[model samples]
Target chain A: MKLQVAIDRVDIPRAVEIIRQVAGTADVIEVGTSLTKEFGVRALGPLIEAADGTAVLGDIKTCDEGKYEFDLGFDCGFAYLTVMGSSSLGTLEVCYASAETHDGVMMIDLLECDEDRIEKISGFENAVYCLHTSIDSGATADPVGQVRAFKAKYPQIRRIAIAGGIKKDQLAGLAAEGVEITIMGSAITKADDIAAACAECKGLCG
Target chain B: MKLQVAIDRVDIPRAVEIIRQVAGTADVIEVGTSLTKEFGVRALGPLIEAADGTAVLGDIKTCDEGKYEFDLGFDCGFAYLTVMGSSSLGTLEVCYASAETHDGVMMIDLLECDEDRIEKISGFENAVYCLHTSIDSGATADPVGQVRAFKAKYPQIRRIAIAGGIKKDQLAGLAAEGVEITIMGSAITKADDIAAACAECKGLCG
Candidate 1:
């Protein structure tokens, strides 16, 4: 499993600093939704540059105007962008098309979406369907089991990712579950030794 | 009834220019989600200052990390910020609390939310429940009927706003249906005389 470290709720300079520390350890370094909302994608040039060679994911959490958001995020140097699964199918279609045009990845955040809604939105073959639990709702009780059930239900969806309070201890389990990416936020970014924490998580993923 | 003009898909200079042109004509000036995503809320200081006393509504479109988004948006001079009705109950609660603490307003964007979800989230007494049709899904079929049905189903939701391709012809009808705010995007902003179009909508609202 690839380790995606989400950097959020911090200022631009601090975000860049954190990226400089953990980018080498994370497979994909995510500029979280808070950073994008607080600093805007245009202002994230520095953060993108700070990512060095690591893939940068901008958690724009786009819900509408998919083409515009995805195009802008890609132009801003994000290798990946996110759209909400709760967005209209039309929005999702446009986002997937935009990502293909730009040769970038689109990660669908499946937060607050029901099975019926997910079933309707499950045909985006290239998009990574993320089983995300909201930060406000706290951590996922059993992320491994959640992934197992999601894969069992949507067997056709080959790419899968998971987020929400993921800890280092859970990395090996997520990897063993055949999850593609496991996103960690405070677990690594807020640690006393962020680089060390990220390395530990990466080691577990390997 | 009030007329809220949305400024979207434009740069900071153009957004500020549009604000200067119509700030006096419209009751509320919205910094649309496109601008917020492309430019970020922190970069909107000049636009906020240029509103010239008109209430600036930043469509931050908070889906999660509620307190951070709301606090940042409100602090950035938005009189109101938006949260998705599709968000978790915990997210909604935190957003409402943040709005109350900031002495600002929270507009719940019911874009793709169903009746069952709306029923569960209708309790934020101070929130303005916005009946939004996705721009990608095309304009609302019958906004007036939609509002009436929404009111009938959830009378407890007192404050109501509606958006998505609202045209000049629909303004008075929406007002007559007791819609609190009618949000117009390209209808007025893309008009030859934006200020005049806004005045015309405001006239209908009055």
Candidate 2:
């Protein structure tokens, strides 16, 4: 299991400070969708550099213009970029090809995606299918159960991730249920001692 | 019929200049999703200001963080903000409530959204349902047929907007089909004379 810390809705400079602070403690440092949209890809250098050899993931959440967004994202130094599972099959296909070209990674955000849609986009060999619960919809109460349900439906999806208001308490269960990466935002970033909070969560994932 | 001019993938200053140039001539001036993400809502302040008395639409394409993004967009002086139909229903609700509270408008970007999903979100009375074709999937060849089919399937939806490679020649047909708004981004913005092109398109809509 990996601990991915998502830093969101903050000023880029402030995010950079947080990124440096969390350096090696996080296996995956996510430049949240808010940051990408707010600053564009040009501002990702600091975050990528601050990762200190750890993987960098940009939550681009691209629904269209996949190749342009993906190419720009990869050029900006993300090991992984995301495409919406609900995007046109064309968008998902191009995103996959772009990621493969860069030898980077692609994570499909399954926010509000139905089973039929998921089935259509299920065959990306290197893509990680994320069981994302929307923040507005509130956190997933039983993430383990959600993952189980998702696995039962799309067992061909080899890599799986869970996100949205993930707490430290659910880490063990998520790991137990074979979730590859658990993404948490405010729970860790907004904590009193960010590094210590991240470390504790990383410890649990380990 | 309305003419929506979408400004995308351009720098903030240039977008502002173009918006200033197109102000009252365009029924709606769209700050494309790329701009919103690239420049953030703060950068949009002047562009919204440039709209003068004309309606400014921010294609924020809120895939998540509906309330925050919509509130930010509204506060930035946009008359309308967009939320993706592919987004979670809760995201749609949050955006709708925010738009209502601000006395603004919500445009649901139906990019890759299926009939079942559209059926579920067809209840927002004040929302404009857009029949979007993905840039990744290329343009819809038969805009008239697409609109006719969509209207027949979702007749309860009162207002309709169509986007994706809408060329100058199709404007008359789209208008005759009772399309509420015909969005032309590249066709107009990329024209030899943007304002002249916009005027021609608006002529057809009127």
Candidate 3:
């Protein structure tokens, strides 16, 4: 499973420092929605450069004007961009097409999406379906079981990612459950020893 | 009736210029979703400032992490911020509470949100319930009729804003229909004389 470390709620300079520190450790480094909303895409050029070859996923959470958002995100050097699963099917289709055209990945954030909605949008083969539990709702009680059940229900959605308060101890179970990417936020970045915590999580998951 | 002119699909520099040109004409100057995804919120700061003491609204379209997105958007001087009506009740609650605490307004973008979802989230009295049509899906065919139907269905939702390709011709009808805010995009911003067009639309609505 790939490890995506989401850096959020921090200032730009501090974020750049964190990006440099965790560059080699993270398979995918996410400039969270907070940063995207706070700094704008062009300001993130330094962080993208700090990626040093790793994938930079901008958690844009685009809900409308998909082509414009996707095109701009790619231009700003985002290897991956996200669109909400709860967005209109038309918006999602545009985002999927934009991602495909740009040779960039699209991750569908299933924050509040229901099965009916998910079923309608399950056709994006190259897209990663994220079972994202909202921070406001707290962490998922049974993430591994959640992934297992999600995969079982939507067998065709081949690419799966799990996020929301993913702790270090849960990596093996998530990896075993066939989650392609496990997103960790405070679990690594907010830790006292960010690099050490990241290394520990990486060792366990990798 | 109030005029909310949306600045969309332009680079940050151009958006700044457009906002400055229309600053006093429109009641609400919207930094549209397209602008939010392009230059980002940081780049939007000057545009926010360009509103010339008029209220600025960032179409941030928060689907999740309500507090983070709302806080950042409000911090960036948006008098109002938007949350997707399709997000979970939990997410909406967080956004509403945050908006309330910050003395900011919440505009619920009801794009593709079902009747059931709308029924569940109707109680935020302070929020401007926006009946939004996706640009990706083309403009609303009959915006006046659409608003009338929505008002007939949910009279409890006191404040109403209508968006998606709202032209100058429709402003009188929307105003007659008791629409609080009429969001016009290319009709004004992409006009031969942008500021004059904005003033005309404002005159028609106001």
Candidate 4:
């Protein structure tokens, strides 16, 4: 139901510019994994500042040393941080605890994870289980269908988010399906008018 | 057998100092995942310079967007970069290609992968399949046994590496088992005399 605009593969100055353009329209602005890995979480203060009062999520995609990575991201002013679902249960638990302690949210990226793995990592009441498709693997075909299936399989997971090449046309379906967050990367960020594109996407999500 | 000293949870200055201390003794000096996430790969030029041709590896741990992350890491002058085995096969393939194109090595970090997943991702001839134990999952109780079992199951994988709380006492067994690379973290980097500890571990590997 919320539009999350992801800014990626750009320098901090450009990322800050994009954040400023979309801050009023986007409910959440994601500092993509590329930015986090390229600039480090500590260096993202400018983008965070540009977001003003809008929520910011850092797609750190933590695979190990969860507490350290999560603490660092939260300390850097990220309201939401991501951890890989493929990480060990202990890693997931520590990340969840860190999020709770920091009063932030945790989004578990379910990229390349099977049902068995997902079933085991469920039950984090506050955690958002993201049904993500890998960029290399191409765009997700049917996000609405994917969310329907995921919800059916793991009905206990309350907070659901979907990401990977999300377009404006699919935002309504995702919102109708009750997806908590719909992440759009290049579609909104690379548009001719960044602010206009984000406003349209935000309107669609409603 | 080779001794790969991992430098983690430290700042750039301290990392450079540790690299200087262990450069002569360590076959490979790993700029640990913590450093890469905290400082970014581009900012590791000093650490790479400190290695002085001891073969520095950036534990970039590419999970998705493999080509971009791999290219960024390899371009940053890392002789080696890591990709997560839990990543999609497509991601793994792109990472492998990037490593090959960059004339660098790719180390697959098998942190929480199962047999079925491993079987699907094997056969990157130049890749070092690292049998890694999650730091959150406690230290590997028997690394030798773990390597032996891995080899028995996947003999096609020729280049093998092992990591996670590796101690001086276990180096001999790992060497005898013909592990290609043994990654030691705090045991070597956190020692009172980092250079001396690295020398002892390298001697044991031989």
* Local accuracy of candidate 4 as per-residue lDDT tens digits, B1-206: 99999999999999999999999789999999999988788789999999998999999889999999999998889999999999999999999999999999999999999999999999899999999999999999999999999899999999999998887888889998889999999998888998998898899997
lDDT string for model 1 (B84-125, tens) is: 988999999999999999899999999999999999999999
> How accurate locally is residue B167 in candidate 3, as Cα lDDT from 0 to 100?
77
Across A85-107, the per-residue lDDT of candidate 3 in tens digits comes to: 98888889989898988999999
Would you list the rank order by lDDT, best first? Answer: 4, 1, 3, 2
Best by TM-score: 4
Q: Taking the tens digit of each residue's C-alpha lDDT, what string does model 2 give over B1-206?
A: 89999999888788877887678889999988777665566766778777888899988788999988888878878899989998889899999999999999999999987778899999999899999999998888999999999889988999899999988888888888889888989787777788888788888885
- For candidate 3, lDDT tens digit of each residue in B62-124? 887888788777887899999999887888988998899899999999998999989889999
The alpha-carbon lDDT assigned to residue A203 of candidate 3 equals 82
Q: Give the winner by lDDT.
A: 4
Model 3: runs farther than 4 Å from truth?
none
- lDDT of predicted model 4: 0.93
Question: Native contacts retained per candidate?
Answer: 0.86, 0.67, 0.79, 0.75
Return the lDDT, model 1, position B21: 87
Task: Please give the clash total of every predicted structure, in order.
Answer: 0, 1, 1, 0
CA-based DockQ, model 3: 0.74
Candidate 1, A44-142: lDDT as tens digits: 999989999899999999999999899999998999999999999999999999999999999999999999998999999999999999989888989
**DockQ for candidate 1, C-alpha atoms:** 0.88
Relative to the true structure, candidate 4 reaches a TM of 0.99
Q: What is the TM-score of chain A alone in each candidate?
A: 0.98, 0.97, 0.98, 0.99
